[model samples]
Target: MKDLYHPAEPSLFTGRESANRAYLHENIRTVDLRSESTPPTGKVPALFGYACDEGVRRNLGRPGAAEGPRAFRRGLGKLPWLQEAPDGLADAGDIRLDTDRLESAQQAFSEGIAQLLRSGYFPIGIGGGHDIAFAHYKGVRTYLPTGRKLGIVNFDAHFDLRSPGDAPHSGSPFFQIARTCEQEGFGFHYACIGVRRDANPQVLWDRAKELSVLTVAREELLGSALQASLKKLKTFLKRVDAVYLTIDLDGFSSAYAPGVSAASPMGYSPWEMMPLLDAVLGCGKLVSMDLAELNPAFDTDGQTAALAGSLVHRVLHYPGLF
Candidate 1:
């Protein structure tokens, strides 16, 4: 109900139209002060941007992910939709954080996300950093009925299980989340894919064991080994009721997604994970979803942004809409 977001800049594509009549630039119903306050029909999934990277800064990573929200929008807006984007598509502008109030900003994000859900819209968060995943989860946790299982599936390179110190940083969200789950007397069933063994220290791995977190390593997402992991993922998926799926762009190989807070040499191509995404959506348990860590500053040819956009397009059209 509050004006939690700054109206997103509508500066988008100026491309030639195709006969297919399927370009996002011509369609996405972007929310401004005037639009989001109105009740959503929920026929279309609500799209929004999280424009802050203070978490990345606190975690001592690169600084440009603050620009991630708009950059991703630019990439998403220009993609040829192949089919008309559904009429219900709503862009709820962006929640921008420009001050030192990261905690309060996260609260605002949580509230905004919750509002979307209550208004009958499925929320799609294009993020500023991976720490925003906590806020995303907060919204889902708040809106769902009590005692429902909340499963978090992160497509990332690190476990993100670092303990929060005097302040919470990007690396500390999952720790905070797991702790919250414990305090709330719920299962902390977190499954992480593409975790690079070398990227995390022994202590983090120990922490994972302590939390009983399910994981698949970077090596496992590759060639022949991936099949077994996919089966494992199926087993993993069967155990959780609803899911909050988050994608940290750094989860993809630097070749496929170089513009992230942390680039990875061993990351898998985004296409390789398509089946997993399909399976996750097919389970019909996906609640809130997010894409994080797209750093336009490091993006070489806009390829990462394009991939992020493509992934979103696929998500919006799941079950073969497009």
Candidate 2:
């Protein structure tokens, strides 16, 4: 495997080191997407994992998320399979962000996503914030011909359907996406999984119902295992041409993933969530994926990053098991 670290930083974490070499090496790939060079196109479909840490901690009006891509890369460096996989995987790197020009940054990110799709590559976006989902969805739209609907599988604790106002933050992605679909006359079928009743706002719930979106609450999902929920998801996927998967870390309980901005005390366990991912991959038309809301500041140990890294590895390696 190639060395993916900068000469200036040789240590992993905030100087903390672990012996999980597979976690650091096997399932990781890196790229600097900010470069002007175009991505190469080839036969076997390519998978580009993007780490965009632009708006990561913007709710606090601070910077540091720019390091998100590198941090995740370092964690992945310790994983071995990522390095050994024969699959066509590349790191598209992080989008450069100008703190003062957020809209421009978003446009750039959206364009990067579009380029990947046009080149016929599957994109797995990592971090920054849930807000990036809007741009990701927009990129997918470019690939769809007229009259095609896009299916979305959002696994998160919150609905993320907050009203989109002048400055749409991370919490307002779904609202923007729904609005876009309505205005453009593009059909969208969205299924929200792992929602906590207490976290969803009334307006969002009303909108979800009005749109005929299928929402599987946490209580209902916890009552059954991941396989059962996935069985239900397959029915939803059949209605659309392509699928986009978004995973907010908060969907997992605090015990399993405490490194998210909105940690939930009761959420899915790793054992439970893996099967859902497996089922989504089985759908065979996964266009793009986003894993968001990972706040390293809140992590006790490196457990959250390790778990996320493992989940990513599984999603990339295991295509389908229907």
Candidate 3:
């Protein structure tokens, strides 16, 4: 773990100074996960960075997401801390991918997440690729009590259940989680929102059906239909003891989130999705969360990163979670 981890870069957390206000950059503390120092005993939101996008490269998507964490921090840092939060925030640093060994890197990251959970900290993972979902689930499973059911709620344009033919990639994280659950004698409860009909194919849809995956299509959330969709989402939430929420930037319309591994011309807006997000977070079942695929290279004036940062901010401000 020490070899794979590095201290959080201090320079990324900088913003305008204010005498009576608190900004994220001003309050977030950088922790050296590799150090011998003891972990926090109180519940706090800890940010973990996965600095690899080999999965995106292998999945044949435009790859620049490896640098997502830095961009996300830059955008998040400037926002003032509005609500009452824990003493401050903690950054456990990044799991650097020095080689092409995505699997090994993910394993190390999962271990780190498990450590955070054991220390009573809520993990907020910033992604290198959508593939981090597998690692995130593994960590949560490791920390959760035995026999407790885990629910996965994903906001994505694609189902992400593609078969891992040669190896796993950004397109196969959920499928990987399903396989892992099956092998371990646990049920896979996954509910995917914002699925674009054109983004996925018949075979993937068939695979989702085979796995008994619950899906709410992009169109289902349009206009008045969102109420029905929310009810369906609430029903799904009742079936699990815990929830792991993941947001893929591409799930939003390209106009709102232009920097992602796969940008969709038509997708849901933040305004349309916040209600759903609030429902999930307020339900008191959310255990961990992540924001994935923010590619700064393609971002227009840092719009996508700011959006991702705002989501993170929302999580931090949610009173129920803290």
Candidate 4:
């Protein structure tokens, strides 16, 4: 466990530190989950970084997302803590990928996530790619009671249900998770928001249909169809014992989130996603969540990274969810 974990550093979280006002960095605590720590009396969110992009490379997308965790921290560092502060916000550090094998890294990440869940911490994963979803789902499912249905709510442009081919990649996480659930005699419930019709092939659509994956297309969330989309999301949310929320930056218009492995020109805006986010986070069913595919290589003036940071800030401050 120690070999896979790297402790968080204060240097990574740098902002205008002040005693008078509480900022995210000012109160964040660095923890080593490899060692047992006392469970917090109240809800505490623990941030863990999956610092590997081999999945992105394998998926034929851009690299450099391996640095995404650091960028996300730097992006979040200066944000003000508006919510009534908790005892501490935990940073469990990065699950570093020390080799070329992405599978091993993903397994290590799942183990770390399972540990956090067992410790009674709300795990928030900062990702190297959307592939982290498979590992994250595995971790959450492992921690939950057997036969409990795990619903996946993914805000992404692509279905990510593509077959793993020879090995799993960013595009194959959901399919991989579905397979895992099937092999283990559990259920796979998935709802994908912000799907782009142009982005997915017919085969992938067929796969979603076969899996009964509920999807809210990009166009539906653009105008009058948004409420209908929200209704669909709500219905999906009601069907599972717990939900795993993952935001692939590419789900948003390239204008809103340009620093991603995949960029969509016709994606929806962040403003359009607020109500949906509120619906999910307020449901109190979220077990774990993640932000994926924030590749610094394509980011312009750190805009996407900052947006990613702001999203996490919103999640932490969002009412009704721990």
lDDT of 2: 0.65
Candidate 3 per-residue C-alpha lDDT over 1-322 given as tens digits, one digit per residue, 9 for 90 to 100: 7778878887898898978557888888877766555666567888999888999999999989999998988888899888666668889898879688999878988998888888778899998899999999999999999799999999999999998888899999999999999999999999999999899999999999999888899988889989999999999899899999999999999999999999988999998888889889998888898888989989999999999988888888887678
Every model's TM-score: 0.93, 0.81, 0.97, 0.97
Stronger candidate by lDDT (1 vs 4) = 4
As a TM-score, model 3 comes out at 0.97
Q: Summarize candidate 1's per-residue lDDT along 149-253 as a digit string, tens digits.
A: 888888899999999798887888899999988898878989898898878999999999999888888888778988988888878888888888998999899
Best by lDDT: 3
List runs of model 2 lying over 4 Å from the truth.
1-66, 82-88, 98-100, 224-228, 320-322
Task: Sort every candidate by lDDT, greatest first.
Answer: 3, 4, 1, 2
TM-score of 1: 0.93
Cα lDDT computed for each candidate against the true fold: 0.81, 0.65, 0.89, 0.88
Which candidate, 1 or 3, would have the higher lDDT against the true structure? 3
Model 1 residue 139 CA deviation in Å: 0.3
Q: Which digits, one per residue and each the tens of the lDDT, describe model 2 over residues 1-322?
A: 0122121222332322446433433323444444444554441223333333444444442334344445565565555444434344566655545454455555666776777676656777766577768877887787667777789999888788877567776777887888888898877588888888788778888988988877877766654454566778888888788888998877899998777777777887877666666677788878788777666667668666777777766665663411
lDDT for 174 (candidate 1): 93
TM-score of 4: 0.97
| Residue-wise C-alpha lDDT for candidate 4, range 102-131, written one tens digit per residue | 988888899999999998899999989888
Model 1 whole-model lDDT (C-alpha atoms): 0.81
